[model samples]
Target: MLASLAMVGLSLMAFLSNSFGQERKIDQIYLDLDKKYRIPEQWTVLPFELEDPYKRIKNGPPLVNVVNKAKVEWISRWIANPKKVVPNAKMPDLGLNFEEIKAVIVYLSSIADKEVPQVAWDAFLLKKDDELSDDEYDKMDKIYNSGKGVWGRARCTICHPIKSVGGNVGVGPDLGEITTKINRNWLYDWLKNTKSHFPDTMMAQFRFSDSEIRDIVEFIMRDTQFMPEEADEEETTEAKPEQQEIQVLTEKEFSSIRKDNALAEKGRDIVEKARCFVCHDVKGIPELMPVVEKKRDNLAGFEKLLYEIRCLACHRIQEKGGTYAPNLTFVGNKIKMGWEQEFLQAPDIIRPLSQQMPKFNLIEEDAKVATEFMDKYLLNKELPQDVFKGEAPSPEIVSMGEKLFYDKGCNTCHAEGTKGGGVVGPNLATVGDRLQPAYILSHIKNPQQANPQALEPNFNLSEDELKAMVGFLVDHVKKKEEGK
Candidate 1:
């Protein structure tokens, strides 16, 4: 995760508050109630996911899917035959029954685009909790408890599940009653890159700003609410009107970062040349870093640090940006010395789920320029120790690596010899004689880069690991040309 503590404070208090609870059954108390209880509203439900309100679920008399034969058969059983087990939908029957209601309800609930309840929503809020102060009660009642934000903003209800309420989708673990389990900074990074902080975890990286992040932290552990009104009215009015902002300070600190404004403003024609926004936020930009983790860092230096860590917004090159690709921060730690040059000179496909990083068509010199900048200046740390060691596998080592190869289940798709896996790749029989170690290394680092449509997986391998694996493949097996 990018920043853990930031997310803790960023989560709004309402998300974690025990002030509300589900009191009555949805079916018994609200669903089966008389028409007088909720009938005044003529309803037109819309899916929350539709970006534009006008483009909601197609308003019509209602349509149903009939793709599967079993579904077609199941609906037929109760529609015409009229089974006793069918349920009722409360709408006056033009011939509708319980089974149709059951079928419709199940279908509607499964769709991501669905509407919030229009009636009895206020009554449901009263059921969230028994004890509550007047102040807390008033604030809680102002907005929809559904947890879906008005616009595109992140909502605690979107990520965290609260009892039977909220999106109730647990993409991340339930923070339901567990705030103390996380540290402040750790929470911030978790919101930044949950999978990185705890590899292969279920959290999605939410790019939020520092202030909103802080507000969430307070809501989760301390104040438990975001009442901008709670601040002193006079100071709130003035609101730290400082001329020297965080954005200015960060640009000065990390001046080497490549920017369109910095060069193009100087007649370098660099203004819109780089699609920097895709990866780098470049500060003072609200469209970037729209949401904060609400746990770690404050929203104070957002404009400044946007350029400082411009890599994380959407494209992760190393660990700086979004996790759309490899953590680009420590890329040097994983690759061999020559492999970087090849990868940059000719871009290759890497991750399977994503579009291949397009080749910038950098003539050798420019490729060298970017590669050197990344290696020497961009990453101001020691290169990965022993990452470039080219291990030449011997018969015994190849034999040993073979066990690890099969044990790790490498043969599912990649076959070796006369056993295991389907044959899809150039057989490794003569791989040792044809390909150079650097080429193999580059392919392993970013599979898509090697062959655009290659079915090869992006193992995200360290140079040392790729060397060992390649040595085993090249030396132990040999591929022959078709006619040779």
Candidate 2:
């Protein structure tokens, strides 16, 4: 009923704008209505299936291969208190006793399909750094540093938050103390074939070479940042009672109980009672709760791309998907289709500090399909077409806008040119080639109205100021060659 009322309001606004041939303040109206009707930070049960991709996604990694992925000790710690291990862990502490945890570990080991692939490392590399000769340590350090460089170039932090920092894209796990959880072999294998391990992962498949993969594994394994901090023994003693020591099933202890069928059955019972299947895909477990799988067999065009890339994991479309990335409800009316298509294929840095589109290795056809769909369906009809009357703003307008740009201190957050500026907002160097003139006007007029989560403050520019600003921004295009 609320949706119908919203639609009616939108339709009425569109009719008024078209009949009078005047630009309506639709953006402000929409923002007002959205704030009033669409409550934030509250969960409500929709009557129909909204198909929120983030909701469909599992917070925990698939447990089928978890035995191979994480160490038994790490698993024990995680089950005890997930937040304690990784500050940003989505998993809750199951509150299972030591014996149950031990049984669970045994059961997991029993169900393991494959062992971690043995990568032959140099004898010195496997040895402790102190045990290694100076030459060996130097060689290891060189490889570690090289991997660190590769890590930065790949922009791993764009998706992954480390110590609750940097996952602006908001898809990856908190990998701050990753060394405590995963072994070097598992990390290497997972990096090599992430899809093979978890088919539903939103992580992009980077085209890294074998050497690069190995280097990343090395860097992650050896890096102090990835490792857990050693607890101060005196402080630890004062903090907790000795009786409160969490029981962990060591590898040796697990090896003994792993083959015990009775224990495995008990573990299965515990898992069922805990409803672990709700978050994890546990093999050899019967359907205690039946799940209806959404059919993706018939999905084509942009829908297929959306599912494959899991675009909804970051981007929000209407009431579906996530809010980590920009809202795409009216992207067609905001962005230039040509630029969007190109960006989908080979993305460039827009927001230098936070937002970055991962290189998904999308084909040209994929980009075309995505952009075409967005252009056709995702638009605001009330926004005036041909905002500048299909003509470039005069030099005077551009010059005034440029002056206002500096006077308004827009450069503090946004960079207009390459030489210097802040990285907090989108780099506006070639924004003219990217965003539509209409969007520029609307965005400048009211930033929060355009994007609820936007940090860009509304300058509340007057009509002339708004027009001039938009003109200046739209003029910031890449200069063409003289011959061209």
Candidate 3:
């Protein structure tokens, strides 16, 4: 089988490196081979080992380091979905060979700024290749100079803006801060043969000669300025100390910025820089946002996405979702704001559902923003006086609703305050105090209207039946609250 052959190859490589002789190049070559198969470079560089990945860093190493937790999870996922990655790749039936896993394990176990596991790995591990030479350095300016022509003529400027002066598609990530976070050699490798890094990363590999690549890299690395001509002007001005004396003094004298939500904001900057909204939903707002695709037709687009996602598939807000998720309509009252903020930064499996929740790999700040957003918008607001204006619905209505709540299988998915409903939906311990009457009214009128084609049944109640149901739902909360 192909898996058998791949394993043989991996074992042979392992033998060559570990048993045959201690030649490190065997490992290096294997690493390179492994590198070719990666999508999104599976490997990453982290800034620090701190709990926070989005911490503001002054400066140190030239590239980011991979977070161990992130790496392990990715490995687990790769094991689960191997065929998606390797073409004709079959190995020990686990999608990855023991040798490959072992090598990666060693890399994962080691800390950053320290020696990595593989032999002769010091250079790559330390990113020594990231350093640029004097001639290479000298050419950086030239690259910037020709950028106007190169970026302008290639149609790249049309899709990707430079200094906010070009296209609107945002097909490419912002490049202004690219130099600060990524390895220089990565840029080279990306320019030279991009697909080799991550088959999924979209940047196309242009048929660029080494000289052209150098030109492009230099243009990209000029730091603050976009034009080589402007860089010359900056250099001229910087040479005169007297001209920048006041500015320098102002910078040194500036007071440190202290804000009410400094830690949260500091985390936010990193989230925006990483641009986490490109794919996964952040869950704090009215609806989730996709990362790379846009749904543009306004109300129609919003309606289309809600219907497609089937909110009830994984979540319940009122009467929608899969039996494997949680109801979120009343989530605001249940959790502390700051805790929500922290969880968004890095979510751990607190309670596993039948299906594992997918991680968005959100940077810390994106998590914070999600936390802040949910706390602000998703919670309850009292219903209009006209709605609550009537006395609480009759006890018969409450009794009937309660009977329907069970007969219709409401408890099949929702647990009473984490009691016995299917773990798939929200716990209903405090729903009464958490949702406004109008909120419930709006949701039940058209389960699809509140959220399109919501997994919850569109009970299709007549106006009188709807009123009975609303009265029942509204009363369920108050009774539960009192019992608690």
- Pitting candidate 2 against candidate 3, the one with the higher lDDT is 2
lDDT of each: 0.38, 0.79, 0.44
Q: Model 1: runs farther than 4 Å from truth? A: 1-314, 317-319, 351-355, 377-384, 387-391, 413-484
Off by over 4 Å in 2: 1-51, 117-143, 168-171, 205-209, 231-243, 297-300, 341-346, 361-369, 418-423, 457-463, 480-484
Q: What is the lDDT of residue 85 in candidate 1?
A: 13
C-alpha lDDT of candidate 1 relative to the true structure? 0.38
Instruction: List runs of model 3 lying over 4 Å from the truth.
Output: 1-386, 389-394, 407-409, 415-424, 477-484
Question: RMSD of each candidate?
Answer: 32.3, 10.7, 27.6
Q: What TM-score, computed on C-alpha atoms, does each candidate reach? A: 0.26, 0.77, 0.29
lDDT of 3 by residue, 1-484 (tens): 9999999999999888887677445567788987754434211222211111112121111111232112333333333443332222232233334333333323323322422222121232232223756655445446556654454334454334554554333334334334443444556666665533332332333446666655555566554543322357667767555532111111121122112244334433433333333331222211333323232234232132233222233444433334333445444533455555555444444432433332323456555654454455445443223245546788887677666667778777666543367655545554444445565666666666555535567777676666666677666553565675
Which residue pairs show backbone clashes in model 2?
none
For candidate 3, the per-residue lDDT at 417 reads 49
After aligning candidate 2 to the native by TM-score, how far in Å is the CA of 5 from where it should be?
45
lDDT of 2 by residue, 1-484 (tens): 9999999999999998898877556688788888756734323222233345566545555677688889888888888878888777777788888888888887887788888898877677677678988899999998889899778767788778888888876678888889878887888888877767876677655656788888888898888778767778897778665566776768888777789988888888888889888877777764664445566577677776676677777788776787877988789888999999889877788987666776665778888988888887777766655558769999999999999998999899889874357789999888888999988888888888889988888888899998899898898887721222
